[model samples]
Target: MHTPTTTPSPVPPTNPAALLRAMFDAAVAAAQPARCLPPHLPAAPAKGRLIVIGAGKASAEMAQVAEAHYRRQGVAVEGLVITRYGHGAPCEHVEIVEASHPVPDNAGLVAAQRLRKRVTGLSADDVVVALISGGGSALLVAPDEGLTLDDKQAVHRALLASGAGIGEMNLVRRHLSALKGGRLAALCHPATVHTLLISDVPGDDPIDIASGPTVADPTTCADALATLARYRIALPDAVMARLRSGAAESVKPGDVRLAGHTCTTVAAPRASLEAAAEVARAAGITPWVLGDDLEGEARAMGTTLAGLARQTARHGHPFAAPCVLLSGGESTVTLPTDAAAAANLGRGGRNVEFLLSLGVALNSEPGVWALAADTDGIDGLEPIAGAVLHPDTLVRAWAAGLNPRTCLDRHDGHGFFQAIGDSVVTGPTLTNVNDFRAILITARP
Candidate 1:
């Protein structure tokens, strides 16, 4: 009698770096406009001129995809979109303007003026499609009636360094802007407005995305002033007066102009995190999705996750080993107070900072591997997406004469990863769904 044939088991990924990269890639791919936009596109207006206007890191790509979709259906489209510098995508009919991001600039101010003029005289038969995403607030910058671009820039810098959340910051931006906080939709009134959003905020609230340029605002000028006071951000007298006098109020909810406008979120941080979980499952690993709305200090979040990873690996309290824990959202970094100390801090983005902190906390824990990256492929202001950490990360750093704790204290995650050649650089992915983090814990053999 012949012996029964045996099938060999497939080999698991021995290199944690490769596995983590695959997970990050899956997350980014899931948020791409090509994959998410088509399904949510509203039918072309039955009998109106289609004018597209948008701003954000993903606005250019969103516009390009929309143009391609309408073109395939023989529908003509025209309009303009503003995106962060170096994030532009080619679109035949829609003009793509590049401007500074995380900071307001003259280029964006000019673009906002042009975009407002485009929608000003539209009739009831005309349709306006607003493609909004993260970074749109800074990229669509047009200061309020009494404020200058310089004044806005000063306030932006202060808000950024104050450890303020995106919601608080956007509230200030909405009131100080000429086109944001539903004013653009008001300008396009009588024209059917369809807004598509790629949310990067914690709650995916349309009102918070790009400061809700095309959606009604529930926040008021007083709220904006309160945010400034909370953050200790000072503004010019005229700018402050505008808020105090309620002259800079945003278009509030129940505004007649926003009655028929439609807003839809085509892609979001939760969807991207779920996509990464799928990749983990396919690899024969259990997936634990921590959350898509996590927010707080970058380093503290990293340390907290490390503790969970340890618990999962040792006690299996929340999850068993052979699992990957995933989370997505934006985390902030508070710069050092001393100028000398701040100057000494090395270059690194928030994602790398999170990863670096995690590595330190893990302290060479065996069989634990992780990755932290921004879905947009740029962490903070750095060129790299983020980085990966393995059990041997700290050992390798020590061998290289680098101290992980020292690097973390200096806020030099980029430097630490670069020294070890473990930085994950993907250039620009043309999308923004916020940060992605994954920790993989393997079962003991």
Candidate 2:
């Protein structure tokens, strides 16, 4: 009589934790600013004054690359790049401004204003290189003329909880700001604009990053109004007036003002995800890349993936044992009721939530280990991007008095994983390629 093993049939490398870490690190290496920011970069036009303005998690490094490119090309450059706090990179010619993320703050407001100022007063003789990446929407916060920081923060917080996709979130953002939705490009009207982007949005739409600060947006004010309504996010009275009054739409394609401008994608999630798949293949594990543009709610997404992994374990239909599952994309979480200031509210981002949900579904199935993380090194607002869970996770959690199902119900995966010391913390990677997820499946016979 054979004893039934709790995991999939064909065992992979005994240490799946190491396998997950390797894949994640490979993904990050492919996306590091130093690697991804160079090619899309062009030689600064000869005899043109170089001006750089940017916003995003990777904007600082993007700025660094721009400065370096122009410097090597003998083009003198002066500019400012705003990124989330701790995402700053040092550049001699460019100012790197650190700001708040997911939520706008005073620091970001000031930085956005200063970035606008940097592009202002420019002439046709000037060349403005806009360096952009993910997370810029919050980093590039500059309320229109009369709006206060408080007002912008309130609106942003509401939209985040609204379950809106990046496109919808940015649509509203473009209407309410001075720097987003190509308004920044408008400010540098006479100057020749060149936007070098590191896309974090699915489908790689330049206009979606940081609400496309320098990219044209065909989305109109009416569309913005509809998005807010669809999300049921209430806006301040001033914002309402701006919308009712027909604010300028972001730069649209074919607009002559943008004909002279150029936008290039320097790096993307697909590139990073592919790189990771290669790492897994090199390790002798076959890799199935679901995609790099995945997006959806945290828990539901996990449930779907959990089902797939289990199928591979039970039937090996899509893939055999000794395989790894790979995917990349940004996932959102709707914070649960903060009532009671829930002390056990787990402390992680979508990755943690996904893992917790996976743990519940997997039910401590032995032999399979997995990891999830934000490639930027931070997961949600927490320092840990994600953690690894083994088949015995259920046993371990119960021993620690953590009910995996209870944690999942409360959206407190972060808190639960923290208690287990399973959270993977890699502070401030300075680049965001969205999120990286990998599951290692080994066969048990």
Candidate 3:
């Protein structure tokens, strides 16, 4: 592993929560576009214009970084990037458009149309720098012909509530989007398109990140239909007809249009976890990275990890105390099947749900504390990133008349944490490497 270039200020060992947050901050800092994107930027074309185009929670910052990097070398840059409403950064050359996320809106629809138009008529000498990352799938929305913006919005809402994984979600998205599934890259055909990605999906698959706008897609419309059927997600008849007729087919591999295109994953979940591990090691605490691509139902993940924490805390087996267990990847939450239960659902993201479930399973087990959050600074639809859980988490909940198990049942992890003053809120981190989770076990047995 490469050494972390900077060390965070040491948080006293007595304060595990502080240390956990410190580690999270380090992970975010390590993945910043300014630090990761510059090294992989493509060289300017000697005789042609340079155009920047992208969409994601991190794309704005990515464009800003790319602009600064090229401007330093005396290259003129111009283009557009779409991001979540609150995730935009200042960019002089690249136009920053803020749009809805997790769900498509009219603003996104118009921006996507502009993006598709922007890439047309490019020549061989032109260079297109595509900044892609998590959340791009929704931010860069161009509904397939015959599908309305409202129709696309409904599809997203169904997929979100359907308990589908990111890859599955993107599969559906790609077929429904005119610009996704490598169609955008096809439009930039003949130009040397270079894509920089900060992956927020499991396996770091370029095809799944932002639905691979600038990369060739191997999946077909039939595959997208299968995913929707598996998840029991239904779409409008127009969308169904488009997929059935193969009218929504994406750009495939070996297509000459993408012949000279390139892609690079500048940052990913594993690297961020390793950065946190470095901080933990410097603080005299052993850090164990369980995996960078864990996926499952949110609450179940919490229960399973709680068992590991208990074993380490009680028996010191597999791993000794005074160690932190770190993991990354996307965890899903399957909303309640019952309408009444869904109606009573509280606001929270998957990260807090995992932490709350973990806390309940621990039952205030001494010397075990944890934090789970999204590195992009938004957990689910909430502005809050995630939350923290300490040995006293349950104790505080009880004292405050908050029932952790009940909150878990109602999908109210955010409310539970916020009520107990443990919710971790970091607005607009400007980078995404997926979820960050850490379980710290002190040496006291």
Candidate 4:
């Protein structure tokens, strides 16, 4: 006699919110370091030490996974990894240090200095595995000569508000950082370096993610200066002088010191999007993955996507009803130009800003619902990830005595969502593959 077997049921299509969240959870789960990093980890060195050094929001988790993978093989490892505050994990072999992210602090400076020292004086027999992911650019803070932590922080603050894309921001950051733009890899000369990356930037450019600490940069100092000028971002006189004098140039590509280094992208935005699409398909919802490298101003992208959703809802030109439109990429929020507005700007990140803008443009369109959140779980500086939108979102805002338009104008997506009790909070997901967005358009009654 054979026992009966049953397949797990797909999420009910009626619960659009739960289904969207499940897709997001599935996407994040797909990029986990435990699942992606081990396959890419290099073999242990036969005669010398296996040193692991890394920095990023996911670095600690990656280090822990790497340590466990090797330990199971009877290979002992020792190293250090730096992660954002509250993102550390317990590990015996690799020391995990917590520091500030999206802005550098004293803790990050000390950690960066120590991390650089750890890789110096290594020989050919030594193997260095760099666990790099998003947020390392700030967590691995090593300012160049004549630059202080305050200077670095100022640059980060300015760039965060400059509406610059990740690639553009990192282009400038590579010049100011001591460990970025492949200098960290240069320091590991003679040692075979294996870099495992979880990409969070569009196009999955290794150099843009975490400013490419272990990857050689092809951009020049002149390019960095051009970016600052394009954004009209001001810096201290000393910082300006450093860039002007070409003193902040990074290690260029093809540098012999960087030879024999290997880089592998363990997880990427495209794979995560595909994972989410699979969930949507299983639920009897047709999934349309728009693309994974979308980029633009947050609100602007929101408006554009709203048009697509409206088109699908009204005419079914692009896709039929009961379908999800999914996309992944980093978006920017250029701060308000007015002084008072800038001073009182409300809390939220690009994902929230995008969602709020989409909700407003949607104008409570029937049978339309959406969710947008950062994969890492923290949107902007706040603990909130992002927000969800329903056909009645604006109606509920009006009922709550909150003006969604005013909130969006002030860049206060968090304020609007929180007041409506619609903010999605998923603190410290420990992995970042940039932003996740899904719009579910059900059949109109």
- Expressed as tens digits, the lDDT of each residue in 362-381 for candidate 2 is 88765567898988888878
Per candidate, the number of residue pairs that clash is: 0, 14, 0, 0
Q: What lDDT tens digits, residue by residue, belong to model 4 across residues 1-445?
A: 1111223232338888999999999999999999999988999999989999998889989999999999999998999999999889889989999998888899999988998889999999999999999999999899898998899999999999999999999999989988999999999998999999999999999999899998989998999999999999998777898999998989998899989899999999999988888888888777878889899999999999999999988988676777788999999999966698789888888999999999999999998999999999899998888989988999999999999889998899999999998899888888889999999988542
Q: Which stretches of candidate 1 lie over 4 Å from their true place?
A: 1-12, 443-445
The root-mean-square deviation over C-alpha atoms between each candidate and the true structure, in angstroms, is 5.0, 4.5, 2.6, 4.5
Candidate 3 lDDT by residue in tens digits, 49-165: 899999999999999999999999999999999999999999898999999998978899899999888899999999999999999998988888888888889888888888898
Error of 2 at 88 (Å): 1.3
Provide the overall lDDT of each model, using Cα atoms, as 2-decimal numbers. 0.87, 0.80, 0.90, 0.90
Q: Model 4: residues >4 Å from true position, as ranges? A: 1-12
**Residues forming the 10-long window of minimal summed lDDT in candidate 4:** 1-10
